[model samples]
Target chain A: MKTLSLRNLQKTYFDPYAGSQVTAVHDVSLDVEQGEFVSVVGPSGCGKTTILNMVAGFIPYSGGEILLDGAAVKGPGPDRGVVFQSFALFPWKTVLENVGFGPKMRGVPKADRDRIAREYLELAGLSHAADRYPNELSGGMQQRVGVVRALANNPAVLLMDEPFASVDAQTRMTLQEELTRIWQERKPTVIFITHDVAEAVFLANRVVVLSKGRVLDQIKVDLPRPRVWDHLMQDETFKRLSAQVLQMVRSA
Target chain B: MIASGQRTGSKTPGSGWVWRTMNSLAGAAVFVAPLLALVAIWAIVVPLFEVNPRIFPSVASVADAAADSIRDGSLIRHIGASLLRVGLGTLIGVVTAVPLGIAMGVSPAVSSFLTPLFRFFSVLAGIAWIPIATLWFGYGFGAIVFVIFNAVFFVVAYNTLLGVSTIPMTIRNAAASLGARRWALLTEVLLPGALPNIVTGVRTGLGFAWRGLIAAEMIATNVGLGYMLFVARDFYRTEVIVLGMIVIGLLWLLIDRLLLVPLERATIERWGLVRRT
Candidate 1:
């Protein structure tokens, strides 16, 4: 059964100063099943992030509906956790505090929240840096904290917008691996957005190609799980899937 | 794994609060040393020039006057009066202005409508209020405090409004997504995010208020630092005047360095886009 569904989703922004109405996300439809990892890949200005934002309920959709387990989303809530591209961990909060903020907001006791945050931080291999502020961490570590912050709530769906796009290639690969490991362990339905086709193929159960505000195609990755990074580039199936998605993206 | 290992792992340097504070104080002393040297030069230069006592008192004579005031308890009374007026006026101004600013700033239309109004008042803050204030309150503590209040109010309000509005929308959105209700959003996100600006506003507002307080005391009040200095001028008591001036300068420096600067630094370091110096 689909855990999250987007039906003919559309987003239109009217720029008053420019006096023009531009549609950011034109009619796009997709379904994400429970425990499934879906990556939305698109060119610049294609509005893949807009779709993710809609799922996260950060903005109102001009047309169509977003449903979680057949219930329409009203606005942003703890049920759907979003990880932004800029690693929007509250700078004022310590790593543990940032991770535990969702639970604290839900009236979770301080001790319990700390334990949960620490557990997630350990999973992200950031247990030692729990008390440190966001500014003290590197870009990669900060993003790790961002991911755990969203996951600490045990949300039904995880919405990520180019989570690793800002990091260096080496750090990106490491973060991608860490993310996959956490997702496997936690089993939250995730909708990841990225412009990198290779990253989309590497981390997704299914890669949805988007172009000019529409989904061009949804390509399923039948590659084996516990996908190792060192061997991924060598695998015939991984290479084929990546090449297909890359071709679709380029053609668009 | 390599990246994680490279992340300044485990042994976080400068971890303890006491050590960090000591480090900062040492840094502050470096900045303060130059001012101390200027005082030393003043002590030497005035005596060497053999300047007239009525024109500019020597450091020794100023010290003697300060000692005399301390013995008589008038110096304490004047300082206490000035501090009380500034403290009360600033407290009232901050309390009222912050909420009003936030209310106006929350809406684009309201903020734009009120921007010019606040700008006009902030420009006319401090000394500009003295004439009307004295006329209304009749040359006493009330008039002096009113001047200080008027000095701080508009500037703090304007800054608080700017602070609240300048917060990035993404941070607010992120907070909302994380299950923050209205009150939580304001206290947790909005307040903390705007803290740096609010602190800056207070600092600037207090500066204007301090000057206004002194000016108002000189013109209208009978028991404050400014009044003491003004009264000393009638007797050609340059020593007393110099003593009063030194006290004012030292007090301002102490407040700015020990209190305001540290507050600004901590807030900006914690939540602002600007990094620590």
Candidate 2:
């Protein structure tokens, strides 16, 4: 069964200043099976993030239905976790506290939540910086905290919106590797959104190319598992897949 | 950064309480030194110029009056009375203002409709209320306290409204998506997020309240610092008036430096995220 499926989803935003209705996502439909990684890649302003936000339940859709395991999504719940592009870690909280916030909200005991947070922080290689404030950490470290904070919720679906867009290239590569390793172990249904073709190809099993407000094509990435940067960067298949995604995005 | 480092430096492992005490004492000396120097200059200038006692009391005469007031316990009585009025008024103002402000702020239509009204009232706070207060409550503690209360309420409410309303929608959405309920959202997200602004409101409100208290005391009350100053004006007793002025100045400095300033600084530190360069 599909963990997440969108049927002809649409969103129309009323631009009050412009005095007109603008459609952000038009007839976009897609699905992700349980434990699958799907990356949605497109040019800027292609409504990819809008789709992610709707799935995360941060925004309302004008039409269509989003089903999770045959159940309709009512509103934002603990069932779907989201990693924001801006790394929206609460400034007042420490690394441990921010990571544990989800479990705490779910009424988990302090000791248990702390243990869960510590384990996830360990997975992100941030166990040593658990007590530090968000502002005191590097951008990469803060994003790592953001990822674990979402993961600690144990949501059935994980939505990532260009989670590494703000970091330096080297840090982005490192975070991608860290995320891939963690995702391999957990194997949650993930819908990752990005504009970078190489990044989308590297982390996803399937790449959905979006343009303007619709999906242009969905390409299956048959790259080998436990994908290594050195090997993947030089592999012919990786080059071909990335080139195809880049061409589609450019044309769209 | 350097100042915060010094403030937190005393928390070093194995640092004794005595060392921390000495460190704060040194910090206090920086403020005290200038006041002492001003007093020395006053003492020298007054006698050197042979200034008239009626116009400005000499340092010795002011000192004598201060000692006499203290010995007679009138100084403490007047100070205690004024402080009690401000305390009661401010307590009522803050308790009522915070919740009402948050409620109004939660709704956009109500908040926008009330913003101008709040701004108008806050601008007219303090002494403007004194006449009506005295007329409504009679000339006494009730009138004086009413004036202080009016002074604090409008400013605090307006600021709190602004604080709560200015919170980014993104943060609220983030909390909701993370499974926060209404109560949790208010207590954990809204309150903490608005605290820095609330503290700023308190500081500003208290400033207005302090000024209003003195003005109200002069007009309505019979036994406070402003009353003491006004009564001394009739007898040309410059020493008592000067003593009252000094006491008022010192009290405000003590309250702000010890209470409001620290509160503001702590909230700013707790909520103010310093952006990375």
Candidate 3:
């Protein structure tokens, strides 16, 4: 089943400085299946983030339609949870409260929401940090909270926009591995937008390469599941797929 | 594993509250040392210079004046009146300004219309209000409170507006995506997000209000510390004037250190991310 469908999606904005209209995303169409993990990969200015933002209902699409479970997305809603690159955890809230925010918003009782939060926090290996604030955590840990906070909402689809781009290289690998592990267990449909070719290949079932705001190609990852850096780093298929995506991205 | 409540911003995380409190007391003593040194200078200079009694009262004479005021209970009344005025005015100012500031924050049109007015008034907020306040309310409590209100209202409103607007777009988006309704966004996100700045505004505004309160009280009221100072001047009671001045300074210090600083430290500094950083 198509959980998220974008039909001829387009975004055009007036450039005040340039005194003309600029098309950021031009005539793009895609479908993400239920329980599918799709990574949208592109070079800078390819409008990959813009596409994710549109799907997340963060920004209005100037043209075409984005349907989630055959329903049009109007504005940001709990149905489409987003994980931001900045690790936008509520600094004022403890990690548990941050995770519980969604359920709380849904009018879940405090005890039940906290239980849900604790469950997600444990899933992220962050059970110990539940009482800590976002600013108190390292970048990697904060992003872990970011991931679960979205998941705890039980959204129809998760939108991640370069969520690990800001973290250190070592932490990024760990986060990517953790994300795949969580994805395998939960099977939450996700649209992961990234500029990183290897990351896109590592995380998604299918990698959609975007060029100049359009889908250039979609690469299916036939790599086996339970993806881990320890094995995947040395796997021949992983290297080949990554190289292909990297070449496309660098050229595009 | 750090205890959430015990996490003092920039302190060794999970430090015991008792330990922190004792250490803060030591820190306060360090802070007060310079003021004590200034008083020592005052003590020595007055006697050494052979200063006239009418010029600057000696420290000992100021102490005697303090004793006399304490005995008569006049000082307590004055202080109580001044405290009540400042407290009521600030309460009113904060209550009214916060919602308006939130309105300004959430809507661009409201902000555009109000921003210039707030900015303009904040600069001219304190003593400038005193003249008009007295004319509006007549010479007494109402006038002085009005002056204090004017001093706090604009600055806090402007700061709150700034605080809300400056919150990153991502955070707001995240909150919305988490199903935060408009009211929830205001209460949970915007209010807490803006608290550090709001507290800062209160701290700054109170400084202005304190000055304005004193000026207004001197001009318009027969009681309070400012009135006490103004009346003492007529009798050439330099000791009484000096005592009132010292009390004014100490009261402001106490308010800032005990009330405002701790407030900022507990909520915003440790929990809510401060607006600037």
Candidate 4:
């Protein structure tokens, strides 16, 4: 069953001074099945973020609709957790507090919320830094906190917007592995957006390439689990898949 | 390597104690330099001109007046009176201003319409309020404190509104997506995000209030630093007037440096989101 669906989503911004209108996203439609890890790759300003924002209910669409689990997305809710590109962790909050934020908002018991937040922190491999402020942590560690914060609520779908784009190369590789492990364990439908082709290929079960606010192609990655970066990069099949994604992103 | 050495030095046992002692001395020297220079200039110029002791006194004479006031305990009474008024006024202003500002700033349309109103009122807060405050409260501590309260309130409210409005939409959206309710969003995201600006506003407002307090005291009050200066002016006691001026300057410097600067630094250190170069 499809966990999420977008039907002919359209977005336009009016320029009063210019006496004209600009179409940001035009007639875009896509669907994601249950437990699917889908990556959306596109060029800059191609409305990839707009699509994600619409699904997250951050902005209203001019036309069409977004349905999550057979219901229209009215506004931002706990059922769809979003991890932003900038790792927007509250500066005043420690790692544990940030992670527990969702549960606390839901009026969960203090002990239960703390326990769940601790588990998510450990899952993100940030147990040692749970008491530290976001500024005290590295960029990768901050992103980990963002992810844990989102996941603490046990959302039905996890939305990631270039989650690893700001991290160092080595940290990015490690995070990808950790993400894949967490995805397998939790089994939430994931929609990851990135400009990096290799990232799309490595972590996604299926890759959806978008261009000019339209879905260009959807390819299934039938590879095995527990993927290792070093060995996988050497494989001819991995290279071929990366080349295809690269071609789509470049042309877009 | 230098960075490592600095880090190690910062962390070494007993180093913090030594560093804090040195830091305080450095801070005090920075504060005291200008006052010392001003005093030296006064000493040189007064003697050079052989100025009338009625209009302006010699540095030695001003020092003697200061000692006399201190010994008589009038200096303590004046200082205490002024401090009490300022404390009460600031407390009332801050408690009122912060909430009103946040309420106004929460909505875009409301905030835009009200911003100009706040700007106009803030401009008229301090010195302009003196005549009306004196009319309403009559000549005494009440009138003087009213002026100080008016000075702090509008400025703090204006700055708090700006602070709340300037928070990035992305941060708010991020918090919302992470399941923050209205109350949670306000407390966690809005308040901390606006803290640096609020602290800055408080500092600026207090500066205006301090000045307004002096001006009000001169006009309305029977006892205070400004009253002391005014009384000295009437009696042609130039030495006493000079002493009062020095005391005012020193007191303000102490409040700004010792109290406000550290408070601002601690807040920014704790809740500031932006990285400093």
Candidate 5:
């Protein structure tokens, strides 16, 4: 079943001062099946984030519809969770509070929400820092809190916008591995947006390449898991796929 | 790279209490030095010039007057009266202005239209309101409190509006996407994001209020620091006038350094999510 579908999505931002409309996303359409790990890759300002924003109902699209579980997305809801690039954890909130926010918003019992948040925090290897505020944590640790916050509510679909972009290279690799493990265990339909082709190829079951606010191609990653970082680099199949994706990205 | 386990965290070689006490003492010294210097200059210059003791008192005479006022308890009464007015006016202004500002700021069009109105009023807050406030509220406590209220209100409202409007759209969107409801977004995201600005506004507003308080007291009130200074001028009691001036400066310095600065620091340190340059 198609868990989520974007049909000819178009977005136009109006410049009130200039008296002109700028087309940010144009005629982009895609679908994600249940339990699919789909990654969207594009150059900077290619409107990939715009598509995610549309699906998350953060902005109004000029045209087309975003259907989640066969219903139109009207506005932001608890059914979908989004992880932002900047790790927008509430600074006033501790790790545990930030993670528990979604469930608390849904009016879940405090004990249950705390339990769920604890599970996700442990999954993200941030249980030890649960009581600490976001500012006290490192970039990687903060991103872990972001991930845990998104996953705590057990939403049907997860939308991530360059979730690991701010962290260091070492932390990024570790987080990628941890994310893969979590996805395999939880199996929520995910639509991940990133500029990095290697990151997309490593985590995604299907990779959609976007350029100039339109879909260029969608490639399938047929590799088996648990996929090790070192093994992925050494594998000839991985190399070939990476080269192909890199070529497309460069051309775009 | 050092192994995590092998890395030893550097210690500052002092207990938290010791460090805090030292910091406070240093801060106090830094604050007091200038005032002490000014006093020393005044003491020396006044005697050297042999200026009329009526116009400017010697240090010894001013010290004697200060002691007399303290002994009689009139100094405490005047200080208490000024503080009460400022305290009451500030409380009322903050309670009223914050919600109104947030409501107006939530809508961009309304906020933009009303911004000019706030700016105009904020400019006219302190000394300018004195003549009218005295006319409407009569002399003494009412007039002084009205002046202080006007001084704090408009500036706080303007700052609150700016604070809410300055929140990045990205942060709001991220919160919305993460399942924050309207109330949650307001309390968790909007409030904290605007806190630093609000604190800054309060500091600025209080500064204006303090000045306005003194000026209004001088013109329209019977019992306060400004009144004390004015009465001393009439009686040619330069010693009392000098003491009053010193007291005013010290009071303001204490309010700003002890109360306002720490409050601002805590807000920026805790809720200011963005890194400083």
Candidate 6:
């Protein structure tokens, strides 16, 4: 139940070899209303990840401000949960414990957190894997845990950074469907970052395409609810929007 | 009758564990057979050649020496003293090294400053410390323990730094994003991520500690397995010398196999942090 705003965000870092400051994310501004799903998609080096990283507070922005629920962002905190490209599940912890970690940090009692963890696991259809370690699961399953782990924390906005990129294609499709189902069920505020054009269009209510660290365009998808690859694969609007985003990305 | 017997066998308690235990016993036998054969050859060779006891005691004589030491309780006292020194030294080494290692890991400046020093000492670490250590502590428990501590400290600290620094950045980011504040991040992410390397460091460092302890004991202590061997040499009690040598070898083997290997394999492999060949 929060709105996130990024105002003229910019990132500049000195390249060691170049020996001069280079801007990674140019002045890009966007706003995501409460419980809205937004996808920021672009080619590599387009600063899509830089934007997410700055929003997640994993790195500092050189200029501009990020506000979540009207409060300015500082360093990393529990309020902004992130799903990494690498899945980043703790190898030593069981799936249940990983999901419960954020709640534990909030000092939720063991029983209460366990309940919370169980609920999230069920939401992700991972209840059976609750006791298993991350390494014991497949890459696709691991990322499923990764998504729910971020969600269970009840962050103001969830930031996902190309989370499904490492998995196989079939699994990726299934995961995309599962994610949409979970999103529709929970209606959490999300800012999902990906480079895949079709994925950006398919998953989001609004798609923001970045080109050369700047906002190239923002396309709002009017596709009907319950978006599934099965139906959307042949849907004319889905194909049109996807082609439009893909054309922009390729041109950029 | 055969079918009934099969049913009873299947119902037996811990059948899987029982099979596993049997497999381990067989594996142990396979490993020990060669060592036992070497011992048998020694037993035969010494008496058959009428080798001088001063040169090397017969297996019977060595066995008798072991029995005598056991009966008099000197062997236990010597072993107990050596173990205590090693345990205390290693304890201090690990406790002190972990924090310093973590500090260096978190800060590049600290690690860079101290890393060259570590590289130099890693080579010069063990027995070489004894002369200076004895000079400082004046030839007693302090000096010997200092040598053991030096042996363990450098390796564990260096490896711990390696461990902490090698942890994937994404993992740390995940923890931070998940609401792990500074202290929680240290205990949860950093510690667990660095565990496998830290365990390896302890194993290698303990090896160094054992060798250093013996060498230090020979020079700086009046008691210990090393001292026992040295005194036996002075009297030409080859039996006791042989006994002490065997005991040192056996103790190290026992510690490695029974404690270190299991610790590394059990927890680490279960976590899938390491793969066993």
Number of the predicted model whose lDDT against the real structure is largest: 3
For candidate 4, give the DockQ. 0.48
* Residue B34, model 1, lDDT: 94
Cα distance off (Å), candidate 4, residue B182? 1.8
Interface RMSD of every predicted model, in angstroms = 5.0, 4.2, 1.9, 5.2, 5.6, 7.3
- Candidate 5 — which residues are off by over 4 angstroms? A15-19, A109-115, B1-14, B272-277
List the DockQ of the predictions in order: 0.47, 0.49, 0.71, 0.48, 0.46, 0.53
Per-residue error at B219 for model 4, in Å? 1.1
Docking class of 2: acceptable
List, residue by residue over B1-277, the lDDT tens digit for candidate 3: 3564444444555456678699989998999999999999998999999999999999999999999999999999999999999999999999998888988998878888889989999999988878888888999999999889889999999999988888788999999999998999998899988887899889899999999999988899999999999999999999999999999999999999889988887788677476554
How well does chain A score by TM in each candidate? Answer: 0.97, 0.98, 0.99, 0.96, 0.97, 0.98
DockQ-derived CAPRI band for the predicted complex in model 1: acceptable
Docking class of 3: medium
lDDT of each: 0.88, 0.87, 0.92, 0.86, 0.86, 0.90
Reference contact recovery of candidate 2: 0.44
lDDT of 6 by residue, A1-252 (tens): 449989999999999999999999889999999889999999999999989889888899999999998999998888888999899999989899999999999999999999999999999889888888798799999999999999999988889999999999999999999998998998888899999988988899999999999999999998988988999999999999999999999999
TM-score of each model's chain B: 0.90, 0.91, 0.93, 0.91, 0.91, 0.93
Quote the positional error of residue B258 for candidate 4 in Å. Answer: 2.2
Q: Model 2 segments beyond 4 Å from truth?
A: B1-12, B16-23, B274-277
Residue-wise lDDT of candidate 4 within A1-252, one digit each (tens)? 999999999999897887899887888889999999999988987888888998988989989999999999988888889998898888877788889988998889889988999999999988877777788788989998998899898888899999999999999999999899999998889999998999999999989888887888888887778788987889788889999988988888
Leading candidate by DockQ = 3
After the best TM-score superposition of candidate 2, give how far the Cα of residue A230 lies from its true spot, in angstroms.
3.2
Q: Write the per-residue lDDT of candidate 2 for residues B182-249, one digit (tens) a residue.
A: 89888877777777667778878899999999888998989989899999999999999999999999
What is the TM-score (0 to 1) of candidate 3?
Answer: 0.96
Per-candidate RMSD vs. true structure?
3.5, 2.9, 2.1, 3.5, 3.7, 4.0
Q: List the residue pairs that clash in candidate 6.
A: none
User: lDDT, candidate 2, residue B104?
Assistant: 85
lDDT of 1 by residue, A1-252 (tens): 789989999999997988999998899999999999999998998999888888888888999999998999988999999998988888777788899999999999999999999999999999988877798889999999999999999899999999898999999999998888888888889999999988999898999999999989999987777777898989988989898998999999
Docking class for model 6 is medium
